[model samples]
Target: MKKFVLKPKIYFNEGSMEFLKEIKGSCAFIVSDSVMETLGYLQKTIDYLNETGIESAVFKEVRPDPDVKVIAEGMKKYLETQADTIVALGGGSTIDAAKGIIYSLWQFRKAAGEEFKKPLFIAIPSTSGTGSEVTNFSVITAEGEKVCIVDEWMAPDIAILDSTCIQHVPQSVVADTGIDALVHAIEAYVSTEATHCTDALAEKAVQLIFENLKALYNDASNSCARERIQNASCIAGMAFTNAGLGINHSLAHALGGTFHISHGRSNALLLSAVVEYNANLNSNDSRYASEKYARLAAVLQLPARTYREGTINFMQAVKDLLKSLGIPNRVRELGIDKSKFENKVETMVELALHDRCTPTNPRLPSREDLVGIYQKVF
Candidate 1:
């Protein structure tokens, strides 16, 4: 039987950061990179915990992609703080790093036959992408290869979505991350494992992201738009966490890890190519995937009378959206040498094939199929 799951009590709205003030934990270990400190959110989070008399320590060394070696180091710091609460206080990378640290410790303690005190995990997202705040999934990189880790026990106990956290995001970042949420929603909606419940959540998230992302990207100070995108991101996260993702993520992980591209940007670049591949647009007749894409087009109010027409329109719509956001539609625009990328094609295909997200893809891809996708994007 197919089952849907949701977790992590969410606190949102303008002053939702205040939720930390009521947390009953004795100590909080805040995990983030230097950006939070530069933006002064680190101090703000500590102040909220301080109001509740919860002492806190900081681990500020996290980097993007969450290198596996550093995860071990973070575990050392996590233990050193003796924290009962674990607060992830940045974007997806920071949260993923925190998850890596927490999950690693649990595995270590279990293997050693020692007691493991599971901390009450809290995630505060500074970006509207990855939905890492609400999902039991994380991406970790080791030896220039990316791996997705999924475990029910790694989900946060609470998620705080304060408007103040996202109100100052860069417009470019807004575009990239918003598209990341779109990828999650669309992938989940067409996933082989999708259920009625996941479809509902994914559809809502898709609608929200399409409607609000452009506005939010144009004006970072638009609190209403920001909240909508944030909510959409989390909703998409919940949907994919249950419905599962597909080869879009698998390809994205490979692309980002190989080229050092930001995950959001990587996903945005690959989205249209992946959509076309999954929807079977090259075929004359529409099928399940095309029908689903057509339905999503109808939701967006695009002209989609026939399933094939709807699917084509939706693909173009995504391309139009990416263009409006100033995102690069072609991989060459990112300035990666064609020769280098070609050289990495085999490795990318291998990584994508082995990715945890690949199994749930609507279409089972062969080696040549993955190579073709890379070439099309390139």
Candidate 2:
């Protein structure tokens, strides 16, 4: 039997951050990054909590591509604070780190036979990427590999989407994360686990991203565009969380972890190659994936006389979009040493094949196929 689940209570809009003032908890623990602390978002969050007479503590150690040690340390803080609520306030990395902390605490409590109550988890995303707020997935770096941990307990109980938080994001980040959302929609639409419900959400997310990403890139102050893109990110997250992701994420995780590339940028760099690989009618035994790509093209109002034409146009559109955003289409262009990348290709392929996101890929890639795709992008 197939099942669909929607877990989080999402609160969005211009004043969504004020929702923090409604929390009934007496104590709150915030997990975020140094950038957020520097940007005053952490203080802003604490101010809201304070208005409700809630005491709060901040852990500002979350880094890009959070590692196991970081998560462990965050877990320790979480337990030490014994807060009734936990707030994850940053991009994907911060939210994921917060989830990791909560997950570890749950495991520890269960193993020790101690009575424990899961803290009310809240996710306030400062970036319009990763949809980590609503999803029950977290990626942590361990021993130079990206490890994806999935469990229902990792999902935030509440998600806040306030455009004010993303207003100051750099144009480059806007491009990288916006494209990441597009990839999420594309992958979810073509995933073997996709259902009608997931397809609807994914389609809407794709449309929102294609229509507003460029506008936001050109003018970050465009509030309408920012809100739309932010909504699209969460929508795509919902779709992927339910339908599961594909090799696009698998490859991105492996590549990002190995080379210390930014997650969204890595996904952007590998998107076209992965799309072509998945849509290869000759290589893949199933036409379903190609048909889905064609449908996506149609949604974007691209010319689609045939499925192959639609697929080609879609790939070209992706390349064009990346170029317009100043994103490099190839890993070589990203300044990774060719010799170093080549030496690590086998390890990357192994790690990607084992990634939790790979099983739902429309086309199950062989090791050779993965290597070829990496080399093509290289």
Candidate 3:
């Protein structure tokens, strides 16, 4: 009994932004971060939207790791203009802000007795990761905890994947975000909830990412790599949204909330450790888990002759990938002290146990298991 939903009308190419002019809407509000505005992408998006004879407003205050306060403020701006549609431009932050605004607006309109039309959101991702455009999940910080919003209605109406949008991204961003997309594919492929549909998507995503992530990291202007990574991100997003993620994301959320670490880097630090932890649980003839490691190792061109060897090689490959991307490999390398991490380990474990994504994990952890995993990463 596997059912899923991926309802976005996507347009991809060099100039898909031109499609904005044909969308029927009264006004289009854009949600973005300061960096996107500096790059002139936001203005370009608004100019095209206005070509449709639609009025537009820009809410360019979406911060990195956007919080509930920011979402509430953006919603107030949305209400002031009574905008009927939204254009999210930039990376994960901008697309995430758009989701927050949509969720808030839905509630407000319902309470005010207005037509509760779902805002028409068109996402133009400027990076090749997070795949926030295609999925209905939005992670917003509330009271220092990252919370997931999972309403199917929050999925964007249109997703524009123009690889040219990522042409000017910094090398560091290219490396971090690219690894994040690869992690998404690998994690979802091994998920307990993974269906045939998700497995197909995840396998393709993994193949594409391994083929192009390094090229993109070294040469941002490589158009071929850009397109491949862009497609990989969307595929990974679709797979993970339906199949769900594992301990890597669960621990990353906690680290991001407590230490204010970058999301991708946090995941980079814990991914291999978490993979090892889960692999250890497959001792009792968990053939599915063993098969997952074998497949992943094969993708990396490793000799996976046995389950234990396969899992070890997979973890080694992940570690090598992060090192090549110049990402820190340990939690302590991020400048956090040991005492603080120890003190907060219990709380982090508790929060992750209740996380929306944890239940679908192939090997659900007990409290002791969570504590042990944290210690291993530490």
Question: What are the models' TM-scores?
Answer: 0.98, 0.98, 0.95
Name the runs in model 1 displaced over 4 angstroms.
284-286
Query: What lDDT does the true structure give each of the candidates?
Result: 0.92, 0.92, 0.84
Clashes of each: 0, 0, 0
Q: Write the per-residue lDDT of candidate 3 for residues 76-187, one digit (tens) a residue.
A: 8988887878889988988998898888878788899877677778899999889888998899999999987777888888999988888998888887788788878878
Q: Clashing residue pairs in candidate 1, if any?
A: none
Winner of 1 and 3 under TM-score = 1
Error at 30, model 1, angstroms: 0.7
* Model 3 TM-score (2 dp): 0.95
Tens digit per residue, CA lDDT, model 1, 1-378: 788789899998888999998999788999988999999999999999999999989999998888888798898988888899999999999999999999999999999999888899999999999999889898999888898999988999999999789887888889889999999999999999999999999989999988999999888888899999999999999999998999999999999999999888999989998888988877765487899999999999999999889999999999999999999978899899999999999999999999999999999999999999999999
Model 2 misplaced stretches (Cα beyond 4 Å): none
lDDT of 1 at 220: 83
**Model 3: per-residue Cα lDDT at residue 251:** 82
